[model samples]
Target: MISVTEAKQIIRANIRALPSSLVNLADAGNSVLAENIYAAVDIPAFDQSNVDGYAIRFSEKDITLDIDGEITAGSEIIKSLSKKKAIRIFTGAPAPEGADTIVMQENTAAANNTLTINDPALSKGMNLRPRGTDIRKDELALEEGTLLTPAAIGYLAAVGSAKVNIYRPPALTLIITGNELAQPGLPLRTGQVYDSGSFALKSALQLHGIRSPEILHCQDDPHELTLALRHALSESDMVILTGGVSVGEYDFVSQAAENCGVTKLFHRVKQRPGKPLYFGMKDDKPIFGLPGNPSSILTCMYVYVSLALNMYLHKKESLYQPAILKNAYRKTAGLTHFMKGMYNAGYVEILTGQESYRMSSFAKSNCLVILPETETEFKPGYQTQVHLL
Candidate 1:
């Protein structure tokens, strides 16, 4: 068995990013940019209006100007402002030619076909957005390592970027092994349990922007498990096996992985709820043998698998953050304990029902509070670390 830190280090050192692909901006959210995005055209291609108001020359503010015409949003014909005249303009409309200022409609009074400025706070270029104000042509809109969030995608779209190159999410395979498992809707026999590891893992994967990972179910037989492992390595970038990793009579993951030519990096970790964690590699593909318990697998997913995903995007980040303990707790020494907890306003509180087989507390938890392997007692207000879910 190895420590949690060693397991994480081994997983990190082995992961490599997937290749980049050119995808439309509409579908590029949550992906890392592979190349710098340069603006092809100015964001506001021409002089634009920021509000629904009138466009006029700064010198004609005090004079009663005649309203020649109106300019709604997206008007392409550039009309020059006549001397001592104003043009009605709406938000996002292009500013009229030779207009140096704009006055909000509320600041002016219109009687007959003329307009009179009623406010003294108006200034030059008050509500007019200059051409290229947001972004200039050929300017670097986004850096290569930037993550494409919702606002980032919107910004790129505003700059007229139809497509962008980004690191694609890896293809994954999840293998579930156990003969005592049954589907959720089926009536279970005496010793059968619902097959929830696949569902929980699939949902968790989707939260990381990985969609539709192939899921396979295999029995405890050695040949079947070995063949399943081989198939997963052949078709997927990463493979995850839940169950059949311990030293029980039915356990077969370690040997099966070895038979399929996988290099074992570690067999266990000194962590509670998931002490039987397994990690290995076949070529560059990573394989994780998580414990079958719901809470244990979920904990491993947050601690170890999420880091491997960050490596897939070449992102250097850690989700663990420091917080203050809200209550006291006690445990035995020699193994690290990860308890389901709620973190709020820099304070973390451990929830109830933390057993490996029970998921009630895990369902209500927003984070996992980390208790070190050497420490057996915890006091309130003590500094601790938490991995956000």
Candidate 2:
């Protein structure tokens, strides 16, 4: 009976960020950092060359110098450059002691252990990467609460972080409840339909970078549903029940949750497609009883469950933004409508097959356009709220 915004607030108020754990940098991708990361050592660790060149103490233009020693990448040669002497160096190699300049190989010409600067524009420190230039030792590398992306991981590695403290993503259990549901790729018996909810929900989770969730199937019976709910709640930090949430005779998800000692936060929101969405909690675990319909489950997941999971990880939640409606839409229902929409170039168009059970339009859509409950008519070029997928 609550508005969508109020329902979201209630759901978030009960959630808390998960505990931090040490994870190898290799496995930290897409996880949020729980601690600030400081550079343990300067990047590059020492003065380095940025090009294949000769390292020499600059003095005068057009001066010939004697070749001292060669230093390639990862070499430990530490020969110092004397007056009018140069050391051959390759990219990433440490600059030899007493060397202050580098002239590109093309800018110098060598003849029989002697080198002459050919370019008049050669300057001191032109091709050198100074020590600690990229990052200083003990500097802040990444802030706390940063999302560990691939580039972030590489930066952490560059700063000598082998492991990091990150907030772990929640483990999930999916209880698919229905007797008439049949697995896909199998022949359907009488009064049976393919079980697309499980596949669709799994894909949705994967799309959001969540790992595969534990899946369980249950019939519509009350006792069986109650047992499945209990087991799922014990196994996961979050449980998603995909059916039997409504008040029909066979609907048992709500009753089962109550029987398992779950506190019902809310039963339904004033929204179409997913009006029967149910939310509850047992101990600290959050449980969602999503409507059985394909579009309804997906819509509720994106709107509510996604936010709950992000809150649990202490990550920033997604917010709605305005977009131009490309076409007109009219609705007489008093409930708020979340229409499947195709969005591009800051414009959105409502797609067909918006009924709760149908996912044809949902498959092609990239956003959901919100229509407020008070007003129902939308015209071309109308600005409305949009939640991008």
Candidate 3:
């Protein structure tokens, strides 16, 4: 078995980034940019008022002025400010020519066309939003490969881009395999249990912005599993199968994938609950066979599948952050273990159960306690790596 890092590197190297598509800015949230976004025009476009005030030329003393015209948002004032004069301007109005400063209405006393500058101790350009203050024409406002966040969307809109080039979302499929599994709300036989892994995996994928994954449930029949694998490979860019990866007699997912012309990348990793994890590729489509247990399925998804997707999309890989161990965490030294835990304020507390089948502890976990293979035991206050969920 190879280490988790080695397996991840293999998966990352094999996956290819999806193609780009032109999408509206409103729909580009959480998508990766495919091209450099250049500013079409200067932000603010023109010198405008930053405050609702009188546009005036700053003078040495308090000067009496006549209001020539009024300018509000979206209105044009062709008049200019002359000496000892001002224009009534609202916020976002273009600054009239010859006006060098804006004295807020609170600082000026006005009656009809006459106005008195109560205090003219302001400097020029005091409240003018200069053209290109936020962005300049032809400037690269956003770089290629950037993950578009809400702020990026607003920025793109401000720069007058109605549409942006972003990477297309990958097509995904999920295959759940097990003979002892049944759907929720259905009566279970004497030894059968409800299939919780599929639901959990589906929910996790949804949280990561993946919806509408084609799901296939195959019992412990090799022919049925092979057929499901073939169908998934034909339609999806990536396929994730949960269960039937271990060495048991009934375990046949790996075999089925191989029979369907999938090239196995690796079958096991030096990890605790997810040791039997499998990664493969068939006709350029990535495939993963995750451990059947609920906790194992979710853990492998977060660590392996999520990383592969991010890498394939050309986004930055999420790394395990360093944190201090809140309490002494002990473990064996051979295998690299990803333990469910809660992290806060620079510390992480490992959850009680590390078993693969345990779902209760996994439900309460908000982070993973990363135990390196070299560390046998950890004392309180010891620093460790943590992967936040």
lDDT (0 to 1) per candidate: 0.91, 0.88, 0.87
Q: After superposition, how far is residue 45 of candidate 3 from its true place, in Å?
A: 1.0
Question: Please, what are the lDDT tens digits per residue for candidate 1 over residues 153-192?
Answer: 9999988889999888788999999999999999999999
Candidate 3 TM-score, true structure as reference: 0.92
The best candidate in terms of TM-score: 1
Sorting all predicted structures by lDDT, with the top scorer first, yields 1, 2, 3
lDDT of 3 by residue, 1-389 (tens): 99988998898788887778898899788888999999999998988999999999887227678888888888754468778788999999998888888888888889978888875467778889988999999999999988899999999999989999887767899999888998899999988988999999999787555778998888898899999999988888899999999999999998898899999999999998799999998867889999999889999998999888786666776667888988787778778989898998888998798788888899998888889987889898888899888
lDDT of 2 by residue, 225-332 (tens): 898888888888899999898889999988999999999999989998799999998989999999999899999998999899888777777667789999998998
By summed lDDT, the worst window of 10 consecutive residues in model 1 runs over 311-320
| Model 3 C-alpha lDDT versus the unseen true structure | 0.87
- In what order do the candidates fall by TM-score, top score first? 1, 2, 3
Clashing pairs in 1: none
Please identify model 2 stretches exceeding 4 Å from their true place.
207-209
